[model samples]
Target: MSLVLDNVSYRYPGSTHGLHEVSLDVRAGELVAVIGPSGSGKSTLLKLVSGLTTGHTGRIVFGGQDMSAMPVHQRRMGMVFQNYALFPHLSVLDNVAYGLKLRKVPVAERHRRAQELLGIVGLSGYAQRGIGQLSGGQQQRVALARALAIDPQALLLDEPLSALDASVRGHLRDEIRAIQQRFGATTLLVTHDQEEALVMADRVAMLKDGRLLQIATPRELYEQPASRAVAEFVGLSTILPCTVCAPGRVDLGFAELHAHTGSRPVGTVLHAMVRPEHVRADPAPGSVNRLQGRTGAQRYLGALTRYDFEVPGAGKPFLAESARPAAEAIAIAPEHIRLLDL
Candidate 1:
């Protein structure tokens, strides 16, 4: 089933809290990650969908029905939390089966369905183990299994892997995606981790101060950010001050760049963003944009070596990166530069 928020807004009693006119849609079988810093309304958005909080304007729609009026349990949306929230006293099997039992499914049928879910989460033999015996990752898998056992129309995950170690987090992220894909469940992931949003979601909604900044695919958000804040938040960038020399050309302290840009007065101070990878070390002899500068600090970072260079008069330094064995020399030139305006 599809899930959608149509111009949804929530407010706290004091007037200084909640989501503001946020609108988004989640299609069946698609994974959409709501990403932002803390207090940006990610959790509030989830509560609205699950009917945990109410008394706001706009509608929460699910499967073509208005969900705002539906009881939380009637929404048929399963939720997985950051802390696992499993019953420590229950065996893994029972923890996964608890929901089915509560719904009054036959005892045999509940156990059968719960075991199936455990298998989907790669916890086949773990059914008999006590919850306390499981590792953080295993515990999260159990939580996922429990959520899935209900055969929910949609899955809402709140920082689902935050409690696990880095390695476990990576593994579980893939696992969650796989399970969701297999079941074709409409899924919404709430997280503050940029990497998690970039790698896991079909699309992302970036929020700030309880407002939706932008919603787009990971590529769109990272490469064509709509604002200075969006660009700075989505990826690594070097925003340098530049003045328009003419159409398609702008002058930086070190080089003249040719790029697509809008009409700005010649003396206007505009910010230009360039990705580190787009930058090269000292250029080849015939490069049009070649600029020379002293390398300030260079460090080897396994897959890539990063260099910090001091541009003669630019207030901020330039950063460039090279793959594998980093270039001993810098090769930046004017032609490789792009002028980004915000």
Candidate 2:
């Protein structure tokens, strides 16, 4: 079912930190990931949609039905929490079947469905195991199965994979996406991890200071961010203050560079943003947009090395990532320079 939030605003009684006039549309069978730093309203937005919190302004519609005032149970939303929230006292099978049991499904039928869901989550053999007996990954699988047991209209995941180890998190992230697709469930995933949002979401919504900043596909969000904040938050970027000097060109005080400025009037102040990957280290001789800079700091990431290239006269170092350490200079492609408002 399609979920829509229209001009939603909520304020805490005595605190200023809450969502404000935020609106989003999550298409049916589409996965939209909400990403932001702590206290950015990602969780608050999820809670509003899940009917966990109330007294908000504007409308929330799900499948063409007004759900803003609906109770939690009536929302028919399945939630998988960060902690897994599995019942320690109950067996895995019972945990999965608990939701169905609350709805008064026949014991035999719920068991059949629970067993089938366990098989779907690759936990068929662990059904009778106590929650304490299962690994964290396995426990998470059980939590997912429990959420799916109810055949929900929409699935809400609150940092579902954050508690697991890196390897387990990656594996389960893929698994969750696969299962979400298999069931064709409309999903809203709240995450503080930008990589998780970029990897799993069809579109990512960025929030800051309890407000919606931008929402776009991963590629668009990364390559063509709407503002300086979005660009900085989504990935490693070097944002230099510049003034539009001419069509397809900008002046960065220290140097003049060719860049795409679209139709921005000349002399308009903007920030030139470029990702680390787009910055070329040790470029070919006579390359366009080449600059002389000393390498300051080097970080050896597993697959690539990140170099902090300290350009003369530029206030901050331009981050560049390459397979090997950088030399004394770097180049940024003109086309890769994204212009954003100050």
**Best candidate, lDDT-wise?**
2
Per-residue alpha-carbon lDDT of candidate 2 for residues 230-257, written as tens digits (9 for 90 to 100):
9888988899999999998899999889
Cα lDDT over the full model 2: 0.93
lDDT of candidate 1 over 213-306, digit per residue (tens): 9999998888777767777787777887787888767877666676555676676556677778877765676665555566677788889888
Clashes of each: 9, 0
Return the top candidate by TM-score. 2
Q: TM-score of every model?
A: 0.92, 0.98
Off by over 4 Å in 2: none
TM-score of 1: 0.92
